[model samples]
Target: MIVRLGIAVRYDGDPLVDFTPMRFLDRFVYRNPKTSEKNARKGDKNVFRRKAYDPLGIKKLAVTSEVSALR
Candidate 1:
């Protein structure tokens, strides 16, 4: 997969600035090989996983943020 971060800035009395011309980075999505039909039937539907890398660590960050918000 590919990951990209776009930044846009606008200064007062100035033109809009866009940083979307930057190149995208490569990312990996992993799937559990052991997730079989039986597991799917048992409600183990989410077999895909994301890596915890710089710039965007969705897997770890999302879980922690959601848990904290529930408190």
Candidate 2:
């Protein structure tokens, strides 16, 4: 498994919405409950920044919109 997960999109601007992902996210991602807002914005702003790109897990990654779309 990769050390980090890159968020490919922004889930902001929703007032009344489906927050189910937040719950599921806690299972797979390491969340700082106290500073999640700031940390999420900075880290998730770049979708490819933290993706491991090698057979052994490197830094350079290749991600397409279809990748998240498939999930």
Candidate 3:
């Protein structure tokens, strides 16, 4: 779970609030433009997919690798 903290405001002469908390999932879903003809025939025109990545894993690998001797 991802927690986002920020201030929310209304432009219609509303009182200021301290902060707002928003919750989100680790996985994200988005529509793909390249939809297959079979899917379109089945009434599923938009192709939805999830993008997965591990930033921590890449950072760890970079830190553990040996530095170049030319430096």
Clash pairs detected, candidate 2: none
Q: Estimate each model's TM-score.
A: 0.15, 0.15, 0.17
Where does candidate 1 stray beyond 4 Å?
A: 1-34, 44-71
lDDT of 2 by residue, 1-71 (tens): 23377546555656454457776687658855454575677766554467554653332333555554565
In model 3, what lDDT does residue 63 have? 48
lDDT of each: 0.49, 0.55, 0.47
What is candidate 2's local distance difference test score? Answer: 0.55
Ranking the candidates on lDDT from highest down gives 2, 1, 3
Q: CA shift at 51, candidate 2, in angstroms? A: 20
Residues 1-71, model 3: lDDT tens digits: 22365656446542343222221221223434565677768885455655455666435455445642222
* Worst-scoring 10-residue span by lDDT in model 3: 19-28
Q: What TM-score does candidate 1 get on C-alpha atoms?
A: 0.15
Error of 2 at 59 (Å): 29
**Model 2, C-alpha of 8: deviation from truth (Å):** 36
Q: Which candidate's TM-score is highest?
A: 3
